[model samples]
Target: MTTDARALVPLPRSGPATAAGTRFRLHRAGIQNVWQYDEQEFAFGDGRLLLRGKNGAGKSKALEMLLPYLLDGDSRALDATGTGRTTLAWLMLDGFEQTNRLGYLWVEFRGTTDGGDHRHLTLGAAIRASRSTQKALPTFFVTPLRVGEDLHLVEGGKPLPVDRLKEIVGSDNITDRAVMHRSRVAPELFGITDATRYRNLTQLLHRLRRPTVGDRIEHGGLASLLSETLPGLDEDVVEKVARNLHDLDAVRDELGRLERTDTALRTFLTSYRGYLSGVLRTSAQAVSRELEVLAQRRRAAGDAAQRTSELRTQEEESEARLETLREEEEAARTDLAALHDSHAYRSLHELSEHRSTVEAVHTAAGAAFTALSNAHGAEEGAAERLADGVEHLGSRLAELGTEHRELLTQAEMAGLPTGHLGEAVALPRTVRSQTVETQLTAPDGETHTVQQRSVVRVDTATVQDGLGSWQLRPGHALPDGPTLASALRPAPQPGCGVTAEQVERLLTTIALAPAAETAAHDAVYHDGSWRLGILSGRHHKADA
Candidate 1:
């Protein structure tokens, strides 16, 4: 059972060895610029190569030529050094005037692996003004190379035609024809694969020309270049940290936006709350005023209701009195009607008619008396005229008597008979009355005789008969029979068998009834619900 401890332990293991890390070293760079330089060559020696030149002598330009080789023909690296591809192209073409001129940059480099094997490689790039673009944009081309076992098939020290360079590389051999692919080509030729290492080498060359002076090396400085170029650093870890930093920056931006939104929302809510408070205060004040007014209205309504009740009672009482008055009026009218039908009333009415007839007769008799007086004055005037005529006739008779005496005397002398002449000459001396006859036309169109008699005479029997028909007394009260009958005559009785005072009072009450009823109606319309207690007083409050 004794086992060898050395045999039990796992033997020191060894696997197939991996190819070592790669590095690129610049040897020489050639530039041909139509404007700044005709054709120039720069050589770099091992360890601390120093260049001395005047300010415009192409010192920077010579150093910048290494960029295309180190960065695998990335013209943007040249742009970082202030020599843009297009500017460099235009300068090569003699300040943009000779745009057709072609410029060339060729870099020769040595790549050494960790196993100590080394290879010689050349990176070639061409620049020319683009014919197709408005700014004469520079066009770049990487001159493809064909590496044999020991030499480069691509031409050196001269500009190669871009088409020939494409044919040499074969379309699939280069990733982009216009851009240099030294990184890809170097792996096949010298076994170099790390592109970041190549970029660091180029950056180191850039920093050598413009070394940073600060305590911490700035970006793209020698320290940063060395850190990136060291094989010990993990590329994947660096990339992951960079990604995490980017995500952190995005999170910070999102947080800032959220903070700003919160501030804005707070401000808006503050303003809105203030506005709402003001609105609510105004509404409260309005409601309070409305409530006060409603309270006053409620009190007034209560008073009105009380007054309405009182008025209703008065109206009912007045209505009752009116009904009673109406009944009394009907009874009085019935009594008055009965009184009118009584015999005493009839007798009184007849007496009144008789009195009216007597008065009419008296008025007619007075008119006839006036007419008779006028006729009597006319008769007196006629009598005076007749008397005057009779006096004259007597005087004539005296003169006739004297004439008869003389005739008797003459007859005695002549024996004539005088007695017969005296008798024949005798005349009467008395006034005689004459009758005047007048014919009057009556309203009936008949003519009647009116005799003007010396005396107007009345028929005693007709006068006696008229006197017997009516009793007449002067300076005495009307006969008791007519008086008693007039006293017994029917008169309209007072309404309701009530006095004029009671009727007047009833009329006054009726006049006041309408005003009371109107008040009651107004109360019913305005305060009906409240008076009947159907709704609370609060319900009467108006909206603000």
Candidate 2:
């Protein structure tokens, strides 16, 4: 038996109290009209009892009539010796002169019920044996009738018949059925309600009964008796086990097959995923190249448009100035016609001729000063041109290296197998990119916004000494450049269609002033640098 999954030792006082606080102590046990004696009885000491007798003195006979036979009504296990020699028929018929016999075996238990009340329960068997029939018929009973006090199994020296016992104990208290007698003893006499546990208790009691007590004390000792008495599993119970062991083996075989299938699939997918990635990466690189080419065309178109817009503005300005000069000329001609007919004009003619000569001299002096300033500016412009050329050379070197790397990458990617591109060669992925807005002053002095956009790039490289395998490599991104937007914005605008790359070439023409502290109209800043245009005092940042 177990409680909370822990095994219980069959030790005394290990369990809780029984119902009604009852304890059924064997008060007396006896038999009559069945064996050597016409009537016999024994009393127990404090519920513990022992029998003592010489060989052939009917002690074994007395035990055979009362024991498990009375408890279970089983005549086969009556001997207590594990021997089948002693039986109900032999006990009732042996040493008897009478052709027919009627007998009884009984046990009385005295105990207390709830509230300290006295109680007595009697378990008994009535036996009838006939010489003519060569058989013993038994009827069992369990009742609250106290033996020797208010109930008796015998009267007039012969055991009472079943009718006389039933009349005394009542039909409800007596049963001819062995099963009913056994069922009542556990609950009514011993206060044990659980049928299975009661059955086990009785079985253990039967197994532990000692038959060789005399021999054990004289020869074997207590240790030997206990060692020999401990029970082991029955052969029949052990045989039924392992009947389903073969079914478990079949399930294990199925699991082993599935594990092998899983391993094979994992191996194939590892190689296939690499091959697929390589093919996809090659396609992406080709698309990037095409995009770069298209971008260059767009930049060229934009530059052309800028130049055309600037030329149109210049033409319009020239026409307006020419119109103003023509209007001034017509007014001068009308004034001259008036002067020809006036005396006042004739008087100032000589004075006007002298004033014109003075103005001519002033104009010549101013022209010489202008030529001197132009020569000085030309010398400074030559030095600036040299610095500009050096910067351009450095930029060209970087661009050339980039171009070389791109060409090498293109050649390598071209070797990949992309013949089945449309047939699921590509893997779709959600691409995340960064796009920031920045201000750019175009070559024609037009200010506009452009997006500086970039995304992470994935590349596939062939593994060394491998069979059709490629490894993935991710490209690191460059850091963002310095801000060039004015205080009015302080940051780049977003969602502008113009890309930095498109106007980058024109932006490079405006030299950046490295020494300038901040942006102003005279020291303009654009595209990540400050720009003080070629020895300029003041330069227009932009108009609207």
Candidate 3:
């Protein structure tokens, strides 16, 4: 925690050129508020810088912060000692209890344009650590803006936020997103045109800087990096080499084939040597025949020359006619121009335009009238529907009134309660009902059907309405009347038959008595139809 890296100072200027010719080399790099240093700047002598110090002098730590981390803003690769346990958060927060710390690591390159003009590119990485997050975040940026001159990444003893930094530099020049920074740096710094190659290069740098020899560096990787950075053979040259190799292989095969063919042809010629001699004599006579054909071709050439002369004459005549037509066209154009300037012609044109406008307006009006007529028809249909709905409502109202009167008459005739909600109830035209029957198997393998009944709740009104009559609450008694216990029986299910002891316990506890017999005593009876008040249950728990 107490390690302090020394400041990087440029060696005494021995030469004038910042970097050799147009080649870019490290010029300046530093860490601000990184590790044990608050502010430090290092300058490279020519293209190289030395960090010579004792073991704990923080030389390697400085390289860890500035080298690969600043180069590509990859925190995982920010380990110079090849230790697998280094991190950006550990770099910033290892020595202190501060919850947050911010730092900047940057490297600038000095180069010249092709015209020998001075040029520079500044690559910077901003690292931040938060104790609560236990993580380190980094932002990468590239700009022509030199540190402490054109722009600054720090102000008032604090690292500027990414947004503020963007304002100072530019949105296009600063980015926290790793991909954006990589894509831009590849083009602006390395002149890489494709993203795939740039990504491959980044991966190589990452692996090399991570201090771990993990994945084998394949020839494909070396070939790709060297293919872009180093000069490569021209595509045409490589293709030609491949083609020539293939052609050479084919030529060897063809030569072997031709040698066999030549041997065969020589034997055939030897056998036909005399015949070939006579054939040559005949071929000599055919040459004269060819001479005659040549004479005929000469005659055809003369005819072609004559035809070409005739075409030339015809072309001259056509040229003269074309000239005459052009003259006529020019005269016609002049006449047209004069006609356009005439007021009478102009009036005719205007009249024609007005006629077109009138026709358009008439057409538009007809379309509008048709739309209106359609709207009127829709309105008439809606009115008819409204009338039919009103009539239907009247019929329903009359029917309800007649039904109400009929219910009142029935209530009076049957001596039932009516007119008030507490005394009245209503029933729909159809009532939905459900019934369930359960069959149980006994230990004797005999099936017992349990007599089951479900109560259906009838509709009752709580508000006064002239709708229907009401009936009194229903009541029932046990089938055995006074000796209700005789009718009581246990319905046991399969695999869970009731024990004889349990049946005896139930029979002894329950009383078989009627209301008259146990009226004066407080006794619980075993009457299946038990209660005296409502046969159905109360709907609300509050009522109970």
Q: Top model by lDDT, which number?
A: 3
Worst 10-residue stretch by lDDT in candidate 3? 520-529
Q: Write the per-residue lDDT of candidate 2 for residues 1-544, one digit (tens) a residue.
A: 1011111111234345445346778778876666665666677655655655446566556666777667777777777787787777887787776798888889887888678887877888888899888788888887878777788766776578789998888888777777677788777765678776666666655665656666766785756554454445678776666665657788799889999999998999899999989998998899899899989988989998999999999999989989988998998899889888789888788779978987786676466445534533553464345345434433543453354344333323333222211111111122334556667554344665644333222111111111011111233221122232122123223443333442232123212311111221111112112112422321221111
Write down the TM-score of every candidate: 0.30, 0.36, 0.38
Q: How accurate is candidate 1 locally (lDDT)?
A: 0.50
User: What are the Cα lDDT values of the candidates?
Assistant: 0.50, 0.59, 0.62
Q: Count the backbone clashes (under 3 Å) in each candidate.
A: 1, 0, 0
Q: Could you report the Cα RMSD, in angstroms, for every candidate shown?
A: 42.0, 50.9, 55.5
Q: How well does model 2 score by local distance difference test? A: 0.59
Regions of model 2 farther than 4 Å from truth: 1-21, 212-544
**RMSD in Å for candidate 2, one decimal?**
50.9
* Native-structure RMSD, model 1: 42.0
- What is the per-residue lDDT of model 3 for residues 223-274, given as tens digits with 9 covering 90 to 100? 5554554455689999999999879978999999999999999999998997
C-alpha positional error of residue 287 in candidate 2 after TM-score superposition, expressed in Å: 99
Candidate 1: residue 445 Cα off by (Å): 99
Give the lDDT of residue 467 in candidate 3.
27
lDDT of 1 by residue, 10-108 (tens): 222245434334655555555554345555555555312355644655555555654533345554555434445534444454335442655556666
